[model samples]
Target: MVSRIDYDRDMVQLHEDIQKSKETPIIRKDRIRKSNNNNTNSVHKETLEENIKNANTLHLDNDIYSVYWTDTIPDHIQESHPYIAIMTSNKPDHLDRLILNLLKNALVDPDRILVFNDGVDPVLPILEKYEMTANQLVQNSQTHTKVKGDQNQKDFYINQHYRFMFSFIFDRLHLENIIVLEDDLVLSSDSMGYFTLLSRLMKYDPSIFCVSAWNDNAYLWNSIPDEPLDHLRFSFKRQNHFGGLGFLINNRTYFNRIEPAWREEGANYKPWDTVVQNSMLPEDSCIYPSVPRSQHSPILSRNYKAITSKENEVDEWSFMQFYNPADFFVDGKYMKVYRMTMAPMLQPEYDFNLDRSIRASVEIDSLYAIGFLTTSPHSSFVFYHRVYSDKDKDWELVTKILSLVGIGNGGVVRTVYEGVIETSVLGKRLYIVGFYSKFVFEKHRATKAKMKLNDLIKLVDYGNAHFNEALTKSYLFMLENDHSLHVKVAEQSESCSTHCKTHNFSCKEPYQILLLNSGFVEYSFTSQKYCKTIKIAENSESELGNLPSLYSATQTCVLPNNPSKISCSYTPAKNENVTRKLCICNK
Candidate 1:
């Protein structure tokens, strides 16, 4: 078995540390067998009688949602459809190497890429030069002749980009569902299988609106809590809006009945949310909630150059597998966590809300950030937090959940949206493909939320597969050097008299502590400033002594003066694991 911890740091972060390092051992692709090809168009295997019985008794409500849905859907559909189209938006002069990094991380087969210019055509030349695969080609009017991403339509451009993309969803592919991507997104290896499964499932269910975990409301009237990537955890059971969702759509039906309203609303509202909102069947309409899940935007994002220094670290799971985003059944043990709401867009501003801030946490076991939502300005977006939960040990909750694979919640959905009563169908049983655990905290990052089983699985998987693999450093090294900490210096003892010379030691003025022999100490350490903490112990001997000193264990610490505990944790790190095991000494 492979060791979970990478004890060799220099080996992992070889490039920067070593002038040149040995090539990473190639893990032959042959070892991992590709699953057999499948046809997603397969007709249902169950008899009409069984289907009716199952739909009514077990798989009841089509509205029961989850955060861990992204993973199961893939297992169910991989035999059928195996590919997803990643529609990446390109930008220029990205100093952070985000574009390159994501391309390396994407689970998408580069051949299936739809490089939307997002209006920046200049990046095309760069993309063309760097893109590795032939299928990874640019898509503009010239390339996608059948689509509306032409050189024109600058007037309604804000909404146009979204409209054109929607039009393209139906225009380009023969597949019933498509997985769209933005350039900045970094996908895991499992994303393709996950999307394909959901797409196949969508083809079977005419009413399933979309299969993503992200939700945002740029065009709504009130504050809607953004859906976490635990795709199974929290869902309107039938509410639709927006977040970066690995959104699965019934393109033909969506375009035919909803496109007109989308067009009209697009004309009125400059934001894409208007068009998406109009796409849903209104309250009076009978066919609207036929599936109960079509949406506008479920996401969060930024352009490469605009906010490029850091990788957009997102929670890894969705509501696909777990019963709740905060609690779930893990390998034999019940895993429970308590996470706060770190951020809420369009709600109480950062100053007003203290509960929802970004903080570091081991929320999930494995996560796959297949997709999230971004915007035209790069300031705002949403996401489809798709997650895949791996159940290593069987527990009662896990067993019970497994027993209900294609089953729905207990009874019929008594609630009606828009007077259209929805029914539970065979596929209505919410098995998932990816996870959807999405929590957005604006400036205050310390107050983040917890995740369910599916989220945990995705998070763990992301770390092993990407960060520890060849083109990178294992997370251990990353945490060791993490400098985004807000530090503080606490004075344990009272100030000494003017002149005494027994236990006094003089600490250099520049350094934080001054221990003078006379006991007169002008002792100081960094105030409440940019600081981060590890599990390591901080002592005067380890910090200020002249002898070769040994460091203590690293642990996450709190600096409360300038920012609260939750508010202090900086932005997330991708495939990013924070270990409270490393220790560093300021020499």
Candidate 2:
């Protein structure tokens, strides 16, 4: 419904473009919803109402834009579980605006806010004016650091500020989690509470390394359905971008793992955000909401002041929906993927023997067990390669099934010989599983001969084989007998088919009637970095039906290397009625 610029621009500019230089909307007492549903303590209702009434009477020009307020401290807040707001800034106005925003909208204790001042501008006056005199504000006016007098120096200063903030939070305060922000950002009404919930989730799951409040895909805000906003938060292995604007960090990971790793590398040449982003554990991800909780207020950031001119851009979506802890789910799909090592590992038989005579018959051999292992319930497929020297002096490689383990603790194995063992207890079956590996080398002929005469060489040979162990042995025991393997296999096959059908459409390639964000169906692709947004007319079902049949079309988008052409025809999804026809084509 809203028109956006073709080029990527700041939110302020978008606001200005829409409003045409109108005065900024002032916060009014009536605009404040008289409810504590916004994660506010009910006791704050009276105090907030009085404050709003007083502000309205004063007719303040730059009133704090808040839709809700509360004075009743939450349990986490009352227990001194204050979230330290670490802000890096040289601009006094920026710092003042950010602190003002926090005071009005954030749910964190104001006393715990920390400011790392990079400029000589006295921020304490600003703090004192905003009733933040007790705030822990520190300054790092380091001018002696050898600067090449370039952008690199500016980048270095940014990292230095962050280093100082992290060190203070890690060693001095010894806090576990912290909310960090750039000075030129404003907090949404629900930001502090949102971060609190995310921090709690981080404590519960160690795999979540960071929690971001800024969404890079905010441009697609219109395409998202607002109804599901309260229920979903995307868990991504890769972030949309470096979230230096607003993010939560686990100080344990920062101090124990990331800081040590950065120092070990001499902390040279890389951006601070990049250092932190790359320092996450191999299997961890940063979780963020589809809708962002913070708005980037600075169009011309201090570091980028050289590139962008000072322009007042209007921001329409500065305020967003309030979210609560009880309505959010953290686990979701990854937009881009990283290494997934959780897949099963398969090893069918032993190797490194000179003789192939020990190989089992086809019926008993584990190689034939691939089918049973892969199709087993709650399992992931793994590929393994094995090499062996045959009696004829030829080397051969074999691919075989190593093991089948269930998701979590459902599948079990008792012995390597019996892949997934199932035992019936009365009428129920139980499963228990374990995976183990050992190295064993082929016996030397001379040692074998000497062992026949003396047992001393046999012990030495055993020691050598034990040291060179080359095979893995797995065992699993059935813990429950209620599940039938045959039924599971059938269900898994059907599930896999459905999953494949649902996710088969490639986002990069031309998709046949692919659903985009929310209910928008992508009927075409114009070989561009971003897709153009269009709206469908309010046509009746009868008018829309056969509309696609009446028209066939092709579109092209210009690329640097070549032009991309997309063809389309009216098509509906499987089992869909005639009114649902849309432009769809596939390569």
Tell me how many clashing residue pairs each candidate has: 148, 35
Among all windows of 10 consecutive residues in model 2, the one with the lowest summed lDDT is 341-350
The regions of model 2 sitting more than 4 angstroms off are 1-81, 143-148, 226-229, 232-242, 299-587
lDDT of 2 by residue, 346-371 (tens): 01001111012111101112222222
Alpha-carbon local distance difference test for all models: 0.28, 0.37
Q: Give the distance in Å from residue 444's predicted Cα in candidate 1 to where it truly belongs.
A: 41
Cα RMSD of predicted structure 2 = 24.9
Candidate 1, position 425, lDDT: 12
Error (Å) of candidate 2 at residue 539 is: 36
lDDT of 1 by residue, 1-587 (tens): 11113212322343233224322211112222221223211232222123323442112222111112332112232333333444433334431143353344322344444555554435555556665444445355433222355434433454555566666666665545555554434333234433443344333233344544232211111111222233222223233232243444556546654467665623534445445544543211111111112221122343322222322212211111111111323465433332211111101121111111112221222212111101011211112123221221221232121121211111111122211111211112111221211132333233433333343233333333433331112122222232321112221221111011122332111111111100101001112221233122234212211111111223223211110011111122222223111111121
lDDT of 1 at 206: 37
Reference-based lDDT, residue 94, model 2: 76
**Model 1 root mean square deviation, Cα atoms:** 22.9
